[model samples]
Target: MERRLKISSGERLLDRALDEGIALEQECGGKLACASCRVVVLQGMHHLVAASEDEVDMLERAGASAPNARLACQVRGTGDIVIEIPDAELPPACAASSPVRVTPRAARHLAAQLNKHAGAVAVRLAVERSGCSGFSYRIDPAGAIGDGDAVFESHGVRIAVDAASLPYVQGTLLDLVREGLAHRLQIDNPNVRESCGCGKSFSARSS
Candidate 1:
């Protein structure tokens, strides 16, 4: 959808596009923390401001190092410019009723772990904004379902998640992965777009 617009001097590209009713994704509210607002400059690149070192590093980390790629939030246009907004719209979040599956092996493993903590009713699974990749999963033994918590049961084991964490983890599968002699618990999430190299954090495809 190519549309012509008159860009003013020092006008932020994101603001202008949004004002024109473009649904560009800015997951971090244009804070440069997420590269969801990346746009490919088709022409008039010279009219746009150069990207800062921070923005460059962030784009690199996000694997958006195209020659013409630019963060819509980071650049301002001084004149008419042609740019293409990629079809990188975030995936729609799953409904609250969507279930997070737990494999039988994971259920048994988690059950044993929960048994060690007396009175623990379920394992709380939540996501927090952390690490370079955007979010990290937090797990804790939940004693009770708190306010705005959604509870799910699988194989006699219950998993509790806060309302805020539900979208990022919906349709996720909890499994026990074995590699040679090593074994670890893994989260197979459908909403995750990319993960940190160390596997400690992930960036979700958010709407």
Candidate 2:
């Protein structure tokens, strides 16, 4: 079925489709690393940039059926377009199964940071629009829990997650791990569908 999906100059096809509530399967998180997000362009091929060399390679490997077949992840929207997901399977409704988990390492790190910053009260978790993926995680010092906020104590530190941000980070594990000489908070989120090459942003859908 052809649907009118408005594609901005830089938005990806999958992201915009989701924005319009048209769910499409994208198991690889729109990383351009999987075939689950393939679609056949029904019109507006010229509106899209020609497939990248790597994209062409991936498509070739998948034995994609047509000249108009393209990876939704690699295709940036330049104008309104028509495309079809040939597979008949219905897209699943994505939702978080539970709140994020705080690992011992992460809780310890949060405690230490909270101690060091005497003015701080707790760690606030937020999800912001970022990266090639639609969102990125943000952590900050929250003096007091906001309305509809999920606040609790884990390990030795207080953690707060607003209702809106809670779902995106659901079933995630936050931990502090050593990456060389520096320490980093590792976000082990199951909902993450794809992350940008630089790791600055990621795209995720609910499960």
Q: Write the per-residue lDDT of candidate 2 for residues 36-92, one digit (tens) a residue.
A: 777888888878888886686555434454778888888886897888876753222
TM-score of predicted model 2? 0.51
Candidate 2 lDDT for residue 176 = 74
Name the top lDDT candidate.
Answer: 1
| lDDT at residue 71 of model 1 (Cα atoms) | 92
Candidate 2 — which residues are off by over 4 angstroms? 1-95
1-207 per-residue lDDT for model 1 (tens digits): 455555688999999889989888899999998888888777888888898866765554344536888899998978888778766432222433457767667888899999999999999999999998999999889999998998988768899989899888886768787889987888877789999998999999742
- Each prediction's whole-model lDDT (CA): 0.80, 0.74
Clashing pairs in 2: 29-193, 29-194, 94-206, 131-201, 133-202, 133-203
Query: What does each candidate score in C-alpha RMSD?
Result: 15.2, 16.6
